[model samples]
Target: MSFSSVSPSPTNHHQMTEDEMTSENSLLADRLHAMLHQEFTSYPACPDYTSQADHSSTCSPHSRRAVVNDDWRRKICEWAFGVVDHFEYSREAVSLTMNYLDRYASYAQSKGMPLSRKSFQLAAVASLYLAIKLEGRNEQGQRLTISTLVELSRGLFSVELIEQMEREILTALRWKINPPTAAQFIYHLIKLFPVEGIYDVDAKRVCNGILETSRFFSELSVYQSSLAIEQRPSIIAYSCILNAMELVGPVTLPCDVRQAFLTRIAGITQLREDMMEVYNTRTSLRELHSAITDAECGLPGGSSSDANQGTYDTSMLASTRVSPVCVSGRQ
Candidate 1:
């Protein structure tokens, strides 16, 4: 007899028992509460300067309008995402890096310090470096050295400049480096699915698909300047899930199960389908995902091929409007 014939079938593998569901819910509740509490504390404040004074006008040359803005931040976000992907590092680290950069930018602007164009790029590199060290490990399980970061900058910044920028970011962020990113929230929120007593393997597979797609949406959200300005991780996370669910539609994911899962999410996050914020976030993510898809199809080599090759072509990336950042090697 074959081994399969002798062994018993594990039919209950996809089923989540009541006790397990309760335990998962309790743990997720506590974690989500802590994330919401810190969300307000570490969230970036809105820029105070709306209108830019003319360069020849009475305002100082280093006005907030003349310095860093959402465009610059968006470029850094794109570059950082490519770097993290090139190194096989966790993309969540990119989100965390943006958290550092955005909060630091707000603090600097509030304090009357000019985040010069050069300083912004330097700060972005340092932010990514710090985030990677905190949460990423190479294939060999080693942290990348400062020298690697300098090389990634193409020697535009030396070790000393990178170190100083890192220190400045830390000080400005009050050393509270850990922000509850949308990607983190996505995983936690997915745990609240009403999976109790469900034994269908197909159902489990669909749920997992939704989760992976939701994470992709979260990654895409990192590149949107408006989403960064919105600064609500929990809502953003909820919106990603909702958009993913819509993209999957009722055909693949049964309507009853989908409704139950969404109900559980709304109960925990207080995010109603009718709320304007949720509607806007979902709309933005859907549009962004569509735009990215169109852009990728136009590229010479698709993102999947580039990822498999373990390198990003700076030339091709520049064609996508991403800033020139050296990410030419594996970790």
Candidate 2:
């Protein structure tokens, strides 16, 4: 299917009656709930195994080795985000790319093939390439080209290698790549808010800012292996939105109303204690939150003290060296 075919239409900003707004919100929420369930069911099995203590020991040795620690994964994700920014890809592209990487890696592990650092990086690049092709489009609505992707990689990878890796990833994943991401859920979640009527201009703006900020945190969570692998995407989306709302302060909805909304979301998403654990970890992790804040502020050329900065970061990430062949082969 064409990217434009599935792309979400912009929310109509025209004034509407409260009942109309509520009806629209209900329909969108139902669709989103169904999408969330589909994505949750489509997740690779490794996430479930990782969440279970007894099952951890049963995982193959190669699987264990392929699972990079959170620190390295964070650095890799930061570097990948830089590339995504350089190419002006949407956050959805990044989210989808990360999803591909995690699922493919898990599949490889299931087959007793651990990915090396270099292999993992290659997988990330390949996933991004696939995501851009699958989700990105130019102003004229043309799909991005392979040469452009090769150039973006700074010649670290050849087209053949990427093509080969893409094939391998697809084979490993059995070609399932359209899984819903946290960004999608966030978009739908914001729609659930009553950002209509005369006063909605500022309210909508605030909600958009909150959604963008939450997306940043959600993308950051992708690198934290535990949260990325263990928690459901819906949970991550919900947590990030809540965290962003906290940062933005109460704007459109009152405190009690917000709580009630959250309760409804939790019930709809069927969230469990693990969701709270993920949220608590994200909010309490000072370094991660600070890094995300800096990254978000730096996006719009804002200074460190600017809390109300713009979208995702555009700054180049600090270089972290890795050997081309430091680790062994994937198989």
Candidate 3:
């Protein structure tokens, strides 16, 4: 990027006025983002649909996801039951360090390298460095000793390599990551009206976006399942990581992450087909009302209690995925 890209312009960065800072920061990051995204191997930019979408006249999208499809199945595999397994593993210092690293991300985005906000993979410190940086205490406001970070990052990137890779990683993400995350998806999904909302002049889309993203999530899960088969962790864990970013807000993807997602997509295509099966049936309006009454009151002859228990996911992803956006923070 041009040095001017990093520097403030007279028209833009005249001073640190709130309005000026906001605009300048946005423009600067745009420039840096443009520079970083020069090399993207763009593929068909659509969700594979996990074969969740039926081709036959027999099955409709509504019937597919509404009735037999297992949304919880995927959500459960990744985040763990009733708990955030990842956060549990994190130390206070670790969270503080991630926050600290994120501070740098804000700094990077504000200054002109939208890199940090765009590519979280680029944001990861080496596993070792990350551990130390995340959870160390020294009187000097130091967390994770420097020696520790160095030891972890050493193989990933040498002192010299760290500089280049850091820049490159950020650059790669600028090319691929986009805003609107899975949490956003879940939010809209949960808030979704039974009917599609439309404004004739413009046409508004809501859970529609998640339609595509849902497919991606399914594909991601199937692919991850294979890679992580009885290994360190499931590939689905990465999906959880990405989804957590959504939970935290803002979705950025490193170019590497994009490639990884796509690779998983291919692997998942087969797996998803095998794992997901579509049925061609739907309850009539009367049938639906009866089922709803039975489910709501826990009436006899209803779907079993065990069936309803799956809805207890506290990840926020579960509760909100089917609803439309309410007031922001999930209650």
Candidate 4:
């Protein structure tokens, strides 16, 4: 079930001229921004249930028995990351999976139905399964099958049960499965802000590095419920880029230019405080970058050595968890 062997090599697009590349990047950025705006207006919140009584039992009559705290939620997401990494699913898949879990949990809570601890992992797995189908594919360009997913889960679930859970999740979510994820926003943002004055070759390399590193941080953000649920995906993506820029230590923009860029990002996301909170507290950019390098360079025994390697050992990532002080502050 390991996806390591089937991982696709990076595609080269060197045939495109600089102007054409910029045009393509700009078009993509516009599309992503438009999609985010559309989602914001159409699904201001997770789709609502048809009836109040339709709320999950764990969030209703058994509400008192369904008290899962943020720490517990973080642990569940961490475990999901382990599952995602072990199977080599895309980071987008994992982030989108957590988005479903969080939004559904939030919607249920709003309806006075909080999920019980016992059912949380089921929801996580179902969300993961759905996200893989939505955002991941095998070398043969086919989505992972239920049997493969079941085996990946170490036989903890059967095909029938997982299918049932998936249906329940979709029902509970009111079929609003496609939401803007941090990774999506980050991809667009990187295109919008290219490295200045570099040749096409070097610019592409630097841009890809920033995108990959920002994506790692964005994936890590999924485990921090306070940040993930509270901030818009664009805000999270913007913060990640800023952190990535810091780590990459590229040429600094002029003060006024930097201020203008921040202003533009703030206006787009409209969650400046949340963005700053994410930057200052929710993630340690330096430590995360180090962990990614360690995982890539095989600092951890038998880890993958490919520079473009996306999957990493969950153990290496566990050390890069958000600071306890940040978690306490959120509480």
Compared with the true structure, the alpha-carbon lDDT of candidate 1 equals: 0.70
Candidate topping lDDT:
1
Residue pairs in clash, model 1: none
Q: Candidate 1: where is the Cα deviation over 4 Å?
A: 1-17, 42-66, 196-201, 297-324, 327-331
Candidate 2, superposed: residue stretches over 4 Å from native: 1-23, 44-68, 139-143, 152-156, 196-201, 250-253, 271-275, 278-281, 284-287, 291-331
lDDT of 4 at 136: 66
Q: Which ten-residue region of model 1 has the weakest summed lDDT?
A: 48-57
Q: Report, for every candidate in turn, its global Cα lDDT versus the true structure.
A: 0.70, 0.62, 0.30, 0.60
Indicate the worst ten consecutive residues by lDDT in candidate 3. Answer: 276-285
Q: Write one digit per residue (lDDT tens) for candidate 1, span 168-206.
A: 899887799888889888898888776543454355666
**TM-score, prediction 3:** 0.25
Whose TM-score is higher: candidate 2's or candidate 4's?
A: 2
Summarize candidate 2's per-residue lDDT along 1-331 as a digit string, tens digits: 6465564434433434555867876788688778876765766325522333224434786644555545445566666666555545565676778778877766776667656656777788789889888866844466668776676566777899889999999988888888877778877776655444315336666666666667766766676667676666777787777766655434344566566556666666665435556556556433566765666633222132233332323232221233222112221
Q: Per-residue lDDT for 152-259 in model 4, tens only? A: 556667788888988988987789888877787877666555346454235556566666656767766676555576666766677777765554432323334444
Best by TM-score: 1
TM-score of 1: 0.78
Write down the worst ten-residue block by lDDT for model 2.
322-331
- Residue-wise C-alpha lDDT for candidate 3, range 131-210, written one tens digit per residue: 34334444445354433333433343345544454454346334233322222222332222122233221112222332
Which residue runs of candidate 4 sit more than 4 Å off their true CA positions?
Answer: 1-26, 43-66, 139-142, 151-156, 199-201, 250-331
